[model samples]
Every structure is written in structure tokens, then in C-alpha cells.
Target: MAGDSSFDQDKNKLAEYETSSSGSYKSSRGCFNSKTGELMGRNFFSWIKLLSFFFIFCGVMSTLFGLCMGIFFQTLDYYIPKLKIEDSMIGSNPGLGYRPAGGLGFKTINGDYKGLSIYSSLIWFRHGGDGNFDRLRENLDKFLEEYEPGFFANQGASLTKCDFESKPKLTDESCEFNKEWLSDQGADIKCISAEHYGYYYGKPCILIKLNRIYDWFPDPYDINEVRNHSTMPLSLKNDIEKIYEEKCDDDPNKYCPYLNMVWLHCDGEDDPDKENLGLVSYTPFRGFPGYFFPYRNQRGYLSPVVMVQLKNPTPAVLMNLECTAWARNIRHNRLKREGLVHFELLMD
Candidate 1:
């Protein structure tokens, strides 16, 4: 009987060992192990160590990236462009634009002119008392507001009065455009804003300007260049020469920037347009001043404006008016409208 009790005792101990071993094995594979009290195969301490390592690694990498970016940006000027001239998106050639062009103008090109989105090149309005000059003049007023004298002055930004004689020389003075510059004592005086930009006189005024190119300045035409230019209009050439003779013809090399302006020429787009379009006049100046450029993106720098007056255009006729800004650096590409702008003009 004592031998039988010993065997039973040993068998009971063996059975107890097997049950405990099974439980240990299951716990090792579960959410918490009974022996180590670990969660998801890792103890709390081990998890904390791993998370700390990852967090430090990410923080260091992010800090290094941000520091590098800050260093890179610190080298650049906010006001000046990093890329300019040929490297600029505007290229070496500046583009041409017109005023009262913020939104699409009423058009009749077999398409509705209602959508506000787009190039906005059309300028259709009535010329007489019963016409739609109010809309055109209002648009002009808004457009010219920035050109007013106190605009940049009030903002603490300034421009310089630059001349065309020297190349790429920008001064510290603000070249503010005054509305009084457009006033004339003669019959052509109708070009003033008080006269509703001459829309009331059937002599509407058009404002022309060059699209700004960063650090890009215009190289004005010399007497030889203008006289020998292959495609320049005869009338434009003559006008330029007359101005040159009066202003700076004494010195062959030195040209007055105010007088030595980038010449502007406007006429009919086609033979029919030329025939229907009447006499036109340029107010203040014929072209944008050479001194206004190499645009440093100066605050309150007003681009020079040329006011054109269309006098006695054939009533009730649709005319395709094409205007071009001339300079040595400005390439004339009709297809791309580079250095040029085209607009439809009609008066009832």
C-alpha cells in the first residue's frame, strides 16, 4: 500500500506540471504573458524605450530639414527676383497691356461677352451723349487711381524720375504720374479724365503700358535705329524724330529718357480698319519712359502711361485697333502678342 501511494503522488505531480506548462505556453502567445507580465510580446519598459527612440529620431530629422530650408531662403531678397532677364518667365521681351481691362468688355465676336474671366481685350462703348461712355470712364478711373500722385506717396513708397540717356540706372525718386499731365489747352484737350477720357467728344482715350518684367529695362532707339528700322510706321518714325530733334538731338549718344521714351504706335489692324479709323493723338508722351524699368518691384512704382485719343473715328463702324510698344529689347511677335495689344473699338 505504501508503494501504490508513492506512484499516485508522482503521477499527480506530473499532471500538475503539464497543466502549468500549457498555461505558460498560452500566456506567452497572448496579450499578456503570465511569467513576464508583458503586453503584445513586449514589456512596458521595452515599449517605452522603442517609442522614445522613434520620437527622437523624427525630431532630429525634422529640425535638420527646417534649418536647411531657413538657411536657403535667407539668401534671397523678397523684393528682388532670383531669376531675371532671359531667365525670367517674362523673358527678355516685355508684354503690352491696356487699361479698363480688368474684366471682359462687351464683345460681339459670335460669342457672348458675359463671362468675367479671361484676356479682357475688348473696349466697346458709345461715343456720344446717349452712349455708354460712363462705363468706360469708370473703368478708366479705377485703372488710373493707382497712377495718381498721392497713391504711392501715401503708402510711403516712392519712384524716381529716370531718363533714357543712361542705361539701366534707377534713381530713388518716385516718378509719380499726375492727372494734370493729360490736360491740354487745345481742342485735343478732350483727352483729360474730367472730360470722361474724351468718350464724350467722340474722341475716346486709350491708356497703354508695358507689362512689368523683373530687373528688365528697355533699351531705347537711337536716331539711327529708329530711322533705319525696317517695319516702323512712317508716321511713328517721323513723330519720334521730331521729338528727338526738339529734345535731345544735340547729343548723338546721350538720349533724354523722358523724351527718349519707348515709342508707341497705334493704327488699324487691317486695311479696312485703317480706313475706318480716324485721326489719333498721343497725349503727354508717345511711349513709356525708359527710366521706369528694370523693375525692382519697388513699392508704389507707377509704370509710365501713354494716353491715346481717337478723334473722329467713322461712326458706327467696328475697328480693330492694334497698339505696339517699341524698344530694342521688346520683340514684336504678333502671334504671341508680345510687345503688343489688340482691342476692338466702335462708337455709335
Candidate 2:
């Protein structure tokens, strides 16, 4: 009987221990735990405390970064850059660029940001491809529209009527560039915007302009030196001579009208390409007038443009056309496409 009594007491103690254990386990998973975590076996209060610290830390870091950026920006001017010339990355070399542009500001690679396409360098299309030439003409018109008269007049900036002789430069002023200068008062129809920029006839027009350098001016080619140059292209030489004669020829003693021009010349890159590239023409003296330079980051500065018309590019041939800007200061590196632009032209 005593043994039976002892066994019953032991079984009761075991039952009591099991009930306490079950209650503790349920409480640990529900809202609190005593083993280690204070709540839900995951330390809910501790996680909340850590997350609050992280949030505050992120906020403080973001605030500091924004404050630093704001302070840096406060030291800058909107109109002019802090660095100039040798101190600047451009280092006085103005790169040549062309328009009738394509494949710009467009790309997709798993939807991340990247730069322009290599195909943008080529102007290629079939003769009768649907909407091809129309798109090209539209591009020209849109690009040239910025250069038209009164385009920059009401833009809250002063316009100076610049000339190579009298007004050769600007002081906080931008030149009012005229469309007449682009086509020589409608003499060059091949490059005129109304001619569809030569796209209607499958002979396209390209406009070249210098990428601006702040307060930078071209050191022009000497008139007397270029007068009887041996190595210079014939067409550019003739154009320079004509301008010099008309403007500064009469004055024998006083050399007032310097040949202040950033001259432009275009041809095929190679012999076979040149053979395929037919007669080319540049209107408005084949150069950007030096008076239009020394870009000062004026609100409405219009960099002078040189219009290049490929009158008869060979059909069904991929010809590499190169246009270079000539000046004493401009550096040329064909491999780098510096001081010049290289593009492919094709017609079919």
C-alpha cells in the first residue's frame, strides 16, 4: 500500500511539472519569453530599439550629405564656371560636333543608365525608305530653329551686332546670329532649311559647331601666311583669300581686318572614301567668324555654326567624312576626334 501511495505522488508531481512547462512555452511564443528573448522569442523590443537607432543614423547621415552639397553649391555661380583654361579639364581645346543627330539620349540594358550609341556617328538611310528623310529633315529644322532670328532676343539677355572689323568681341553680350549668314542670303540652297537640309534629294546637310569653352577665344590663322600656303586645301585657301581681299585689302599700311576665323574644311577620311565623296560645299565663308567667339556663358550665346552640304555623296557606299576646324589654338587628333568630327555618310 505504501509503494502504491508513493507512485501516485510521483505521478502527480510529473503532471504538475508538465502543466507549468506547457504554459511557459505558449507564453514564450505569444508575447513574452523568459529563456532569452523578452518578447515572442525574438526580442521584439530590442529590434524596435535597434531599428530606431538605424533610422536616426540614416537621417543624420542624409542630412549631413545634403548640408555639405548645399554649402558647396552656395560657393558657385550659375553663369560662369570656377575653373578656366589650364586649370580646366577642357584645357582650351574646343571639340567639333555635328547635328542631324541620331541615337542620342537613348539606351536600354536591363534598364540602367549608360551613354550614347556609336551608331549616332553615322547618317545612313535608303533613298526611298518610308519616313526616313522626313525624320531627318525634321531633325534639322528642329536643330536649326534655335539659330533663327529673334530666337534669343526675348530671353532676358543683351544681343551685340558683332563684326570682324569694328566689333570683334563681346562684353557680357551675345551676338544676334542671323539665318542669312548660314545660307549667304539664300545663295546656297543646298544647305538652306527650306531645301529639307538636302535630305529631300538624298544628299544630306550637316551643321558643325564648336563645343563652347568659357571665356575661350580662337587664335586665328594669319592672313598673309594663308595667302599662298602650300599645304592647305585649295578651297579653304581661296575662301580665306577672298575674305581678306574684300575686307582688308584696300588698306596697305594698316592691317585692321585680321582674318579672324575658325575655318572649316571637310573631305573623305581616306583615298577611296574621297573618291566616293563627290563635290562638297560650305556656305557663309566656310568658317565660324572669330567675332562670334569668346563664349562667356551668356544667357543667350549662340555659337556660330558652319553648314556642310555633301552635294553628291556616292550612292551605296559607306564613306567616312571628316570635318576639321582650323585655328592656331585648336589641337587635332584624328584618333581622338579632337578639333574635328568624324561621321559616316551613306545613301542608297
- Candidate 1 has an lDDT of 0.75
Measured with C-alpha atoms, the lDDT of residue 38 in candidate 1 is 73
Local distance difference test scores for all models: 0.75, 0.75
TM-score for each prediction? 0.73, 0.78
User: So what's the TM-score on candidate 1?
Assistant: 0.73
lDDT of 2 by residue, 147-252 (tens): 7666765743567777766555547877767766666454444677677677767667788888889888888877756765565677788877777677776654
lDDT of 1 by residue, 1-348 (tens): 999999998899557645775587364555766665678768899999999999999999999999999999999988777888788676888778886664444556887544333555667677666876676777778887886666655544454444545455444434556666666557644666778888887777888888887767677778878889999999999998888777764776674555556789999999999998888887777887766665676777777778888877888898888999887877888899898998888777
Per-candidate count of clashing residue pairs (backbone under 3 Å) = 6, 0
Residue-level error in angstroms, candidate 2, position 295: 1.3
Candidate 1: residue 141 Cα off by (Å):
1.1
Clashing pairs in 2: none
